[model samples]
Target: MNLANIQDFGAVNDDFTNNSVSIQKTIDYCAALGGGKVVIPAGKPYLSGPFNLKSNIELHLEHGAVLKAYPDESVYTKSAFRQNMGEGTIWIGGENLNQISITGGGTLDGNGIFFMGDELHDSYELKPFETIDPRPHILTLVSCKNVKMHGITVSNAAYWALHFIGCYDVSIANISIYNNIKVRNSDGIDLDHCQNVRISNCHIESGDDCICLKNRREYEELGPCKNIVIANCTLISTSCAIKIGSENMDAISHVTFNNCIITGSCRGIGIQNRDEGTVSDIIFSNIMVECKQFSEVWWGMAEPIYITAYPRASHDHKDAGWRLKPGAKEAGIGKVSNITFANIRCKSENGIFLGAASPDLLDNIRFNDIDLEVSKTTEYQGGYYDCRPCKDDDFVGEQTAGFYMINAQNVYISNTTVNWGTQKPAYYGNALYAENITPLILDNFNGTAAFEHLESIVKKGKTQLEKIAN
Candidate 1:
């Protein structure tokens, strides 16, 4: 295949000049010739602002080649799609493209620090409603199909590194992402309303969620995010390593995460259905998690696993410093069911929290062959469940258990072990806690505490425990 080198199209190798037009010309020429490779040659950094990609084209960055984003807000103006979605500009994007791939052993640098002001020094402490100078994302693909990204290093993204919206048949492998941990909202990869995606052998370290799957509210017409597989990935984040929702207006189903590692994250796995959606048929297996608390800049309580289904507005109104007034239109509670976590090990500061809004219970959750250890570390305070929407003042200074579930049904636990700290904190109480749960099953559940502790673990409404003989 003939390659269309950008140098041939008046693209200088210097890093100072704006090479956007040159690259676009090269891409257009290659795409006009019935689709070929647009190659950026090695040993020089090409600086550009924003450019749209074409269909049936591979943007190949050779080894030692660097594609750096121009560090000027004036260089990027909001596009029509971005303005409609209330999002920032996109540096490299394509719409309605087919058979597009970005493959190389090079780097794509966003120069994100130039956008974030000096206020983001150690912690991301900003004033009230202070703007972070919204910058363009590194790469975005919308309404595309058969997309592939492999063996590239994406770094310093001001926002998300890679975003796929309303796309299908995607494969991302052998990619590495390094984003500043102090930066806000530098998510590694975001799959919104995308389907049939496979992500494997990736190492991601980000300031926000490492790998996030969402059914975005803005793109409701695109349908749900389903049939995704993520495996053999190592993730580290200031927030959750893997997350779903907080923006789910459609269904999210048939997602699996297998054989992954999570380290130094605030939360291991989180499924937060705050909007009107149904999350079901999710499986997480053969995973290792090590989590600790972070600064107040982030939202999380160092939980190993957190799942919740609640109303969209007024749920965390007080903590969020706002409230929905009377007669305001509010979204109904979502549903979460058929979630499985098996063959997992976790070392964390906080326990598992599973919460559901009244009349919309979490159904058919199961834990199998799990080992969890909770200890009080200097990172943050421990031994308390961080279930939201409930009265926050009531849980203060109260003892917490290993597994806390409220408003759930048909929960099963088998071959699970829980170990607490040697010197139990004042808030360390039980091994398992349940409230308003029906048909709870426990089989071969072993804990450091005695069997009497299990019998006295309930702290709220009655849970009908079903004995399962092993």
Candidate 2:
């Protein structure tokens, strides 16, 4: 309310030396004299493009301001930004006017290694002096509502530094995003089909997927992304530090990922709702992980808390039959119910792949107090005179297997621990790897790794529960 009668776009004896045409003529003279705040004072370097925020505006970037991003393309000729979706007509977006507030702490530079990725798809092929593509994101907000972005310091982004689509009562607090390694793909924060989103105390590091959750793309009439809350984040990812769905069909309910801290990730707490829909009450509580390059865990897909509902044509086309099938009366493969993974701690070189390619679409899965360490990449694959964590041969039963439950159902692995580092590569054999699950509940599951058959699965579950009590 008190933006002190706005109008100071890099003011220092303001002769308006093109601070992007003086912050777009003071935001078109405060939206034709009705709105306020466009001040970006305190030391200067304001070079903008693609900033079309209006309704109740308050876009101030104080504290030694450095709002730079003039990768130029006639400064975006809007249609509410030429229909966005991976956006790249060059920069800023907050689709559809809303009460916006982009707070300060100064610094929003997206010179972004000078727009790689085929010059941002040749400026969306609308060629006409085209050649200004810088990976497409310095900031994006689609289908906006009451939005608030706090204390920013967004770094090199030509792609996903911060993006929110189908937004709702959103609030992104204390943000700081980093995109080094030459900013390839550059994802640090992306939440599609957003709902009551609240991302707090962020410090995301990225080359890709530091924090992502997207849904509703197959025949999109998008709706259904409920009560979201992600707290106290500090992720370091080269990919997947915390992810959900790969465009969930059209439903991601009651979500809550509490107290996170993941390190050197290629996969640490990832869930891919196999491209259909319906991912129920999610919760990944009190996590702490450090899995330094677990042999690249196939970073670009293939097991790392991965899931599948399988109608496979690489997840069938033609709207995947509007997915929601749990008992198939209407198509198939879509349903990952009430999930919970409490107190997780992991260290992998290929370990941890939880069930469901079937089993009527994976149900009530839980793994409490879980712990893992399946090291042994052998001092970086030189084999270093074959250092195999004191190999005695059964090397944890051919070294590869911590938890792979396929076709899963009411599965639970409580109070677990599996530490078999340095006998890696019999394709990662087991600690608990079930197939065609019927009855699985290994409580107080302790580990040292080579549980080769774990006494024939506890003597065939005590003779099949005494043959169902005779």
How well is each residue in 360-428 modelled by candidate 1, as lDDT tens digits? Answer: 458999999989888767545665544443323223224556787887888898999888865456666
TM-score of 1: 0.91
C-alpha lDDT values of all predictions: 0.80, 0.62
Query: What does each candidate score in C-alpha RMSD?
Result: 3.4, 18.7
Per-residue lDDT of candidate 2, residues 219-282 (tens digit): 2454777788998998877667787765566777888888888876666777666555778888
Model 1: pairs clashing at backbone N, Cα or C within 3 Å: none
Each candidate structure's count of clashing pairs = 0, 8
Instruction: List candidate 1 stretches off by more than 4 Å.
Output: 79-81, 84-87, 119-122, 125-133, 314-328, 383-397, 449-456
Model 1 accuracy (lDDT, Cα)? 0.80
What TM-score goes with each of the models? Answer: 0.91, 0.35
